[model samples]
Target: MRPRYTVVASLSRLHRTFLTAPSSSDEGFDFIFYMTNKAKSINKALNDAVPLCNNPLVLKIHEAMRYTLLSGGKRVRPMLCLAACELVGGQESTAVPGACAVEMIHASSLIQDDLPCMDDDSLRRGKPTNHKVFGEDIAVLTADALIALAVKKLASSTSFGVSPERVLRAVLEMAKAVGTEGLVAGQAADLAGEGMSLEENEVGLKHLEFIHIHKTAALLEAAAVIGAIIGGGSDEEIERLRRYARCTGLMFQVVDDVLDVTKSSEELGKTAGKDLIAGKMTYPRVMGVEKSREYAEKLNREAREHLQGFDSNKVAPLLSLADYIVNRQN
Candidate 1:
């Protein structure tokens, strides 16, 4: 089938835009400053969205939800959603609901993923897995609650200034990212690949890409696309953001695989070298470490090319974000 969207501009035009130097104001743009401020904003919204002590009967599950959802991490997905919205000239307030919804979905996935039936991980984000702390049953329900609450937040929490149609579109994008076509599909493939013998090199690059694209990139794609939709970006503009998100999302997984080997347990805040021990299909495993690094660089470049036509100052956050993904130790 043909893709939903294709590049609207020629390669020359994209490269010229990519190579244009950032203006003086953008030169001084501080990633730490932006990240800190955005993280604070997101945290506040998330806290308000999923308030603890709401009801005595469900307090246990609520705790489990917040334990994982609010745990400190980079908050990359939500940040991307907000940044994409601003990139298209939308107010940050308009995107806050969508941003929080994406994070809830992301956190829900991690909770389920760390269960004994899945990755069987004991640690995540520098703490015990939700299932480990709250037991498997609560952890499962926690995932369910978060998914439902995420949709609720998206449908109800967005400002009335945004049209109902736009909010519905954003919710639809978020739903797609979580269902059979997105995270679940990628995870299922990943598990199936793990069941095969590690000695076999049949797990090729194409297969690896499929797994990562669906597993990791799917939600990230939704993040950017939903933001653009909420921000009222044109079809062509939304498509470009999707392309940028897809590249960075894949880069995220590739870099993660590399970090699994290169970083220590203390550094990564989780088990180090776990992927190698598990013999999971990864870019480093298939293409070798050096080639994987090269591939990461290529993906980063391709993602930046998609950002070319946008205002330079407006895109500084995303441009810095791409670089951050490549170089982040964890």
Candidate 2:
């Protein structure tokens, strides 16, 4: 793995040259180049941020936390948070706390969502689920601890240069995303919708969209908004970013739904086609795979439209991210 300082240096280089780079050539600013390096940056930052071995008194819980938190997967949410902050001209360091905070919240949600009472999955990112290894009780506590730690990190880990007001706002924003208004609301609605007849569960496009919006889009929305807040964006800029994030978030699920059918378990690094087995609502279940693909494409286009005002060079990461979210097979 690359060292942490190298990640910091890469981010610094982007900070200096990202906006000023010429837009004349397609190869001038490489999308893969940024995505690969930024993911490395996020992974290193996450490893450094989460307390894994500092205290023996809480070592058991820390082990469980590290099991899921450090497990391999694309660090999409945290990367989005950091990218959004940079897109709005914020220092990378200023956004690191918020980025890591969002990821912990995401991991916590996945742990809860995988409980026997919920999706009941046995594998995540090709490894056993948290509850599978830690037992259900420990899994619950581990998740709760992650959520609490996420909030604490956001409230206290921010650089002194960032105002207390912005930090407070970020904390409140993250809290809302994990509470009844966001992920919890989405999960509740999803659980309630299960076991309906095929026709009943297929339901309508509006209902399917609602589940994706709250369950998936809410956190993405919070990430973008919080990043903009820390970057000192104008209200107008933040709203536009919110819209962009909402579109990408839904597209992410739509693509995920499609890939569940198209890929194998080994390729996906999880139980493939689990959505169908659970009778859960998904884009393909209601709209068919082809239409789902079309819808993902449409959402991607719509997401890019919201970034029209930003410099093309600076927006390269965001634009590539929209494509990456949709095109990724796993």
lDDT of the candidates, in the order given:
0.83, 0.81
Candidate number of the best lDDT: 1
lDDT of 2 at 26: 34
- Which window of 10 residues has the lowest lDDT sum in candidate 2? 1-10
TM-score of 2: 0.89
**Model 1 lDDT tens row, 114-224:** 889998999886678999999999999999999999898888744548889888888888888997879999998888777456455454777789889999999999999
Give the C-alpha miss distance for residue 236 in model 2, angstroms.
Answer: 0.9
Q: For model 1, which pairs clash?
A: none
Question: Could you give candidate 2's per-residue lDDT for residues 89-201 as a string of tens digits?
Answer: 88877887788888889999999999999999998866789999989999999999999888877887455477888888888889899989899988998887776577785
